[model samples]
Target: MPRANEPGRTVSSRLWDLLFAFDPNNTELTLADLVRRTGMPHATARRLTLELVEAGALERTSDNRFAIGLPLWRLGTLAPRAETLRRAAQPFVEDLYTALRQHVQLAVLQGDQAVIIERLSAVNAVGLTSQIGGQLPLHCSGVGKVLLSHSTPAFIDDVLAGRLRRFTPRTIVDPAELRGQLASCRSTGTVVVKEELSEGAESVATRIVDGRGKVVAALSVVVAAGSIKLQAAVPSLVASGLGLSRSLGWRPGIPIRTS
Candidate 1:
């Protein structure tokens, strides 16, 4: 709840407030919205917002609203967590997309959510709400299930105990049922989700590991719900996941069924 003009806050702190004001839900903001959210004086907020724009950190849209700019996006890509995994998995993502002509995505576990790092899609792939840097729910999404399967037991218990949102009728809300699914996913290294995240999308996801055999990320191929493509896509999805894992120094000898 702190703002730029607080008695002891620095200019850098103020700048960060402006930067953090934008998120997935609040992608664009007017000058008034910025002032209110950052709790800065009108003139001060306008001044800082304009400075961010000039510095290529914020962009002005056609409607005169502001959004995170391209330069900020470029800088964010340098973040160690996303950069390392993305750089290693991008090629395999593209190859999977090429072979299946579906949408291929790479995601990493972030807190209770799965954050998508890279996505490759064909011109006519099934519509997806997720984009690069966007988040997917852990309970019902393909990548989400894979990442959740590898998370700590306590974390999984906390997640299942919380209010699980239902995106569709197919979304599994029973903790016992979901626990069973998670167990199967952890054992098989792959899962098939049917319209759990969206109405018409199905995702086949698998785990990606590092040399240490630690699960580092998840990869998925998304296609139309009930597409005949599921079976064909599974092998390639698993291979691509394994290939990217090996690139990170993971060995085939390491079993994926580990807790």
Candidate 2:
């Protein structure tokens, strides 16, 4: 593999390295920070960062830091998968939020992780680590489990072969046990998680399918542990997921496809 500052590296690759340095946790960074994070020379980092700012892909902040700019954000919103799913799931998500007054989220599988495409949360709902565009671990989170349950066997095997982080004591790190849970989730189209990802958060999730019966996304509602009956939330969550699926052309007779 080429080093970060290898002479043969392309300008676009360097620019991408700088941009990819900014993530959910480190959303803002100074020029020096970018240089350190990208392992690029100070001059190279500064030049590319300035070019990005000039191109409206990044913006400088009052404190001399940089953040993702509106133009780049607008470009991300144009992603067909997330945008279309969000639009189709909006009404159902809103209804679920109003009916349950909890944290509702819609997520899609991106590689081995579940990326939240849309989310609605009540002011007093349980605290959560994920936000829109944030990711969740497939073995531990409710939405992650639902998405993982419908994934291809090879993909599932690969994910299981990787290291599974134990976020909490309740998180299922044993591949065999987790695999059994996934099998049940695949059969039922829903899974209830209790403080598996976060200490005080519990979630109920269901799969969302599309016209070809492909499992495209997962819809979930998160609440404080033991605050409300997890089972009670299932009906509404599953209904909302099914409703969103129907809007995307899924029907009763269509067999669910795993990708």
Candidate 3:
């Protein structure tokens, strides 16, 4: 049965509904889950899902659940912003990973969340709650804090007034404490977070800016909590971030020195 008083939706809207049903927390879905999420009639839901599967927009798992397919992922890489940023940032990200031998990540702010655009993983790195295409919180993540430091005051206020999930005990929840942290990050252009998002993980991150001084991205290195000193990693992470920013036309201090 169609949902009670469900707004009349077009085919394009329905397609968007099905495609967007897959998110960070809901990556794979059973038919019932899709039907429930989309609130479509069972027959219409199954038909559209099958169409998506046949069109290679989505794939069926071994357990008969559906997930975003390789074809869609390939298509997503062609998006101008994501692909270009991935290309421009890969070398710096690689250098950071090689220097630190830990999990290195590149992220960009998408609305209030930091979207992981790319990552380099080490075999024995600490366990992570996030992966490529995953979202990070604005309060507790190093990259998230860096991005938040540059965000508009309105955005920061809105996020602070909403839910601030505490993944670990160190996660920043107090708005006043977080305000001070943001101020410090804005001044230093970097943040070192200790197990704020995930237990057993720590990160040091800095901002990547463009010619206009607009922070376009964030770079970070994730290492095991207490395995090595955060100070040891901060220099390299900051240098790599500045190098990447310079490549994108950000000049730190002094006026327009040869870009």
Candidate 4:
């Protein structure tokens, strides 16, 4: 039997189920799909869906399909860790992107995923597979590895115990190999991923720290595979990460550590 907190457990949970059903891959749905996805009665789903639409958490498209609303996006912008850190890092990220003429991204750990908070892309740079609000796996992408390296041991173990989807041939699906990669990231304070998330892309990522010297975010620059050497990009990425960290009040002589 399912627990009380399981799917469709309560009205609130059903509402959340309705909301989270929208994702990057499946961003729009009809009311019938919502009922099927949430396992709620049609009338109940209609009521809660309408309530959410009224609350501006979801929107009705011109085709009468529903999707995540602008208000929800605004609410997500209010997340202190994401919004505040993005605001603090924007200028530095912009400068770095301008200098490198590549895709620069800022991301933070949200549960078991790395969520992109902000991104700046060059028109001539490699077409990226990531979106501003998209989530990436912790075992493959550069930003994901940086965030995972800074995460708690328990969280690491939990992720390792779960399914690690292989997005590409280079994606690290084995727990042991991923552990070694995480160790490397901890030792070097940076992560470099090549063709892991996408076949023709490479990412160089570094950690961002707060005044307390704790890792709070990850900064990454993605380029077309083999176009730029990873070693050449590392110094600039590390410097930008430190600059943003300093902007957040992180200073010299403090014991810097990942979260």
Candidate 5:
């Protein structure tokens, strides 16, 4: 296999390597940080970094670190999956946030993880590290479970057979138990998670289907554990999910398709 800095690597690939080094956790980085993260030589890293800054793909912070620029974010908004789903689910997500005064999020499956596309959060709600672009574990998170349940059987099997990380003691790591949970999730179109992903956090999630009844995304409401009655939020959460699904052309009697 070729190394990242091998002579065969293209310039565009090197540039992308630098950009990809910045993520939800490492959102800002210094030139040295980029060099180490991308495994590029200091001079080459600096040159590409400067070029990206000139091209408005990255911006320098007051502390002399680099972060993704506005133009780059604007370009990401053009992606059909994130923008279309976010726009269609905005109103319903807002209503849920207002009613529950908790964290309301919309997420879609991306590979083995669930990526949060949009989120509305309350000031006093549970302190969560994940943001709009952050990812959640498929085997533990409420939205993750909903999306995973509606995924293809082969894909679901791969996830269940893989190493499931135990975030909390309550996290269901056993494949047999999780299989049961996914079965229930598919039958009911929703799942309730209690402190599986994070201690003192609980969530309830429902699938968001499209016109063809393909589960396109998952909508979830997360609250501090024991802060509010989870059951009370279920009706509103499912209703908002259905309302968003309807906006996407889904209707009654359409058989849900596994993606």
Candidate 6:
């Protein structure tokens, strides 16, 4: 177990780690797995896990396993940044999905990861590993790159200093190359990712601005790699992003800067 006064140590933080350990790929966990993953004693893990279950943060399965509960997912809907923005952007996102018949996604920066707040899927669009509430790395994903490009200078430097995991052969790991790409995104108001995160998925993303012209979120359309022209998708993506931004009180006169 971590010491109480250790840097960034807290009961709530540990609790969150326990919660995040559950994912779509690993929805069920045994007590021993929880204990090992959290590095907490079996007794402590059981007690805390029981507490989370009582609080409706985790659900107990018929087989005695634990998974993330719907209550926690509902609580995430209450986040103002997500609730308000997603609600306002839903119609526009839907329209874009209808027009393009592709995977439309809305994302925002949460720490160093891009969290998918909302997504509209076409019946036969390119398959994506990401889902609602799933996270994507900031260096290789379309929405991630757009969100990171608009982040603070310190944050940019910190992300560059950290490990830049290569998801595919085309993933950009060089800081200088990524810096140039971000600069181009800042000027063009869009980021086109070609098979960076997934082997055969491509995404075109644009930044959504708020009333103050701050890039609050990113909107993207994922398509099959090399099948669709990225430039052809830019206009629709930009229009949808701007429409959502306008719904958030962004005006045309304000200059929207990217990175």
TM-score of each: 0.86, 0.95, 0.86, 0.89, 0.94, 0.88
Best by lDDT: 5
lDDT of each residue in 1-259, candidate 1, tens digit only: 5546787888788889988888888999999998888888899889989999999999999999999999998998789879978888878988888899999998988888999999988889888777888999999999999999998898899999998999998899999999999999998888999988788888899999988888888999999987799889999999999899999999989755333
Question: What is the C-alpha local distance difference test score of each model?
Answer: 0.89, 0.92, 0.85, 0.87, 0.94, 0.87
The top-ranked prediction according to TM-score is 2
Per-residue lDDT of model 6, residues 23-45, tens digit only: 77889999898877777767767
- Global lDDT of model 6: 0.87
Candidate 5 lDDT, 56-91, residue by residue in tens: 999999999999999999999999989988988989
Q: Which residue ranges in model 4 land beyond 4 Å of their true spot?
A: 1-8
lDDT per residue, candidate 4, 202-249, as tens digits? 999998888897889899988889875566678888999999999999
The lowest-lDDT stretch of 10 consecutive residues in candidate 5 is 1-10
Residue-wise lDDT of candidate 3 within 1-259, one digit each (tens)? 4442267777767776889888889989999999888878888888888999998899999999999999988899897657888898989999988887888988888888899998999888887868888888878899999888888888888989999988888888999999999889887888889888888888999988887888878899999998765778899998998888888877766232111
* Model 1 steric clash pairs: none
Which scores higher on lDDT, 1 or 4?
A: 1
lDDT score at residue 11, model 3, on the 0-100 scale: 70
| Reference-based lDDT, residue 131, model 2 | 94
lDDT, candidate 1, equals 0.89
Worst 10 residues of 1 by lDDT: 250-259
Q: CA lDDT of 239 in candidate 2?
A: 88
Q: After superposition, how far is residue 62 of candidate 3 from its true place, in Å?
A: 8.5
Give the distance in Å from residue 200's predicted Cα in candidate 2 to where it truly belongs. Answer: 2.0
Better of 1 and 2 by TM-score: 2
Alpha carbon lDDT at 188, candidate 2: 89
Preferred candidate (TM-score higher): 4 or 5: 5
